[model samples]
Target: MTRLDTLSARGRDFLGSTHAIMAGAMTWVSERNLVSAISNAGGFGVIACGAMPPHILDAEIAATKALTDRPFGVNLITLHPAMADLIAICGKHDVSHVVLAGGLPSGAAIEAIKATGAKLMCFAPTAALAKKLVRSGVDAIVIEGSEAGGHIGPVSTSVLAQEILPVIRDVPVFVAGGIGRGAAIAAYLEMGASGVQLGTRFAAATESVAHANFKRAFVRASARDALASVQLDPRLPVIPVRALKNAGSEAFAAKQREIANLVDAGTIGLAEGQLQIEHYWAGALRRAVVDGDIESGSLMAGQSVGMVTSVMQVAEIIDELVGEAEAALSNRAA
Candidate 1:
């Protein structure tokens, strides 16, 4: 059997592909072009439906279908206001998979997606939560760590794989965060991960719609340059987001301090102050991704950004990863 065939049955079956690699859905960057390119390249691509309304998601799904007939998934943030409608849109398109991200999915949302006969995937930050998600009817689990881009949990992918991979027997577990090459993929599969997901590695693919300047930043960055957003005040609520440290991130720190001062002065309620901080990042991702304003826009990236050296085609990236994986497995067996 080939190295691809050596993957766990659950992994191959869940992805329905020769390789179990997945191109992680990135906001603004994972629209029709990148999603379809990855799927056509024999890896699953997920559309990042980050905070998009129902109509926009419908259009994007239709556009992706126009590009390729291969199976793909849609990733929706659990906290989206129109989540129910978004799930309905997936059903309407006969989408094969739905990945719920951001936070714990509501029971109703889970049921709605399951009712569509679509495979439901969720992010599990801990092994305990992995079990709970399976019990709650999630078909697959993606264990993502702080090394990932955008919003992140507090654990590393290696630690999460060790903790969750062995016990989550009911469903396939895919590892994400800081995975930049096929050697890591092979190692994780050996450790019981059914597949792997990568965002930073794929963000600079030729098919990706990220602005040229944005991709350049990724190529030039080192792992040390990718830092998680910091909270200035202990009392205020802050959701840590991982991204390249640039002018935008520095400004975000100042913005938080300003908001915290307002809260201390009672000029704004604590909740409102938190909301203001959230609003500061609202369109920042788009500005960086689409407009190429890297300095002031949030250049969200994972630690793996350091591994990206050039812009290659999606098919080339997949082939490189799989070849590296096969070679690793071969060397180990020898």
Candidate 2:
């Protein structure tokens, strides 16, 4: 086996994929076509169940299954109202792996997904949460740093890796956020990351169903263009989103101000205010990814987006990443 394969054996076996790399789930972009393409390309693909109801997710899983026989996973938002029903849907589909994200999953939700016998993965933003997830019967933990697109925590990928990798050994720990190249993959693997997940690079993949304009925007953007949304009020509790700067970012700031005022005036409860923000993001992302509204749609992208210079096929992307990783390992031995 190649040195890369040897180092990634644990992750490869766990994921039942040729490489330890996983395609990060991006809402509106991670539908059936892209998910199946990633799985077919020898990396793991995850269906983004962002704000999707159970029936839609059920149909999407079935469609992805129809396209690729390779093992792929599904990502479900923990904050969704029908999270339990969504878990049941995954169980019905007999999905090999189920990723719980968007928030810390409840004990019941964890047990419910585990009952389906699917390998369970959850996002851990800190070392303490990583340990807690392992103790709560989580099969794996994905640490996505602040550099990631969409919703993000406060730490960088390197810091999260340093804090969690050596400490969490009982279950495989996957490092994500700002990881776009094989050398970065090799660096994390050397740090004891069982696997790496990338989204921005894959969102521009030729196989992705995202609009042509959306893909173009990604290719044109540099790292500095992707900025995180600021929190207008501490009481509103907005989860910061990372995306390419545009009119949509400014619109979001306005939306936050609107919500904050509503909360201040007792027009909506804190929970309702948060829900409105989530709804707004889901709609805005659809406009950009599905309708080609790049100027005003949410162009969610990670810092690695600057690395995405062009649209490439899924196979080519995976091959390049794997080759880069292999070269990195080989050079280190010299």
Candidate 3:
């Protein structure tokens, strides 16, 4: 039997009822409505709590519960100042899964959540960190490659998963980055991943909260659009973020230079626009996602954006992905 057919016994056990294909925890976009849709559709949905306040996150969690009885997750960015409060809220709501994005969570935070019996999911960039998180008590680890959207590690999923999966025997490993279809999912499963997580494909889903123009951008995006910018000097002070190459990104690159010049001159305060790339929000992204302004907004998409051609409902998206994995496995046998 092929690896896809005989997935890791431990990996399968971790996924339980909801199959692979986890929806990423996108800030501002992963509200209750979107999170509920993915979970109700049989894939795991994560409420992006990275940006919301604790009270707001609690309400969002309640809202998600109102929408579906199936298990879902909450995404907590490890670097945020409010991490403790968010963990408290997750436990209060009995949120079963907490995905620690951006970086690993603090040891105290991890212990607190574990005490609540919540499954912890974290991103590990290297084999060392992967084993470290396993020892740190993470229930599962998402190996995010340089191909993933938003902030990413230097390593690719192919390299990280291959090196880490072999050493970590207890926790399930989910591969993220450049995954948009069933063929990729099947390949990862064959590689011993418990499941695959998708971000860009869902950003274009019918129920996605991203701007319509943003969605179109993702649908039209290519691998070339997903290049990671070089941070020549760490002292320059800019957070490295993975975004599609567009006027916004290019403009932001220039803006960074200007901001640096101003900071050196002591002319303007650096309190706001810390990540000027995000300010491109005022550009086309708002018009595209919220106003359906498909031409103007900066669409945040993965390299897999090119793989998507049409807008599909949540259920259709899940069905098509699963079908693709099945077909690839079947053909491998033939």
Q: Give the TM-score of each candidate.
A: 0.98, 0.98, 0.90
**Order of candidates by lDDT, top first?**
2, 1, 3
Measure candidate 3: CA RMSD. 2.8
The CA lDDT of each predicted structure is: 0.91, 0.93, 0.76
Q: How big is the positional error of residue 324 in model 1, measured in Å on the Cα after superposition? A: 0.3
Error of 3 at 69 (Å): 0.6
In terms of lDDT, model 2 sits at 0.93
Task: Kindly indicate the candidate among 1 and 3 with the higher lDDT.
Answer: 1
**Among these predicted structures, which one has the highest lDDT?**
2
Winner on lDDT (1 vs 2): 2
In angstroms, the error of model 2 at 68 is 0.9
Instruction: State, as a TM-score between 0 and 1, how close model 2 is to the true structure.
Output: 0.98
Clashes of 1: 0
- Report the C-alpha lDDT of model 3 over 28-47, residue by residue, as the tens digit: 67778888888888788999
lDDT at residue 73 of model 1 (Cα atoms): 97
Candidate 3 CA-lDDT value: 0.76
Per residue, candidate 1 scores C-alpha lDDT tens digits across 83-168 of 88999999999999999998899999999999998999999999899899999999999999889998888899889999999999
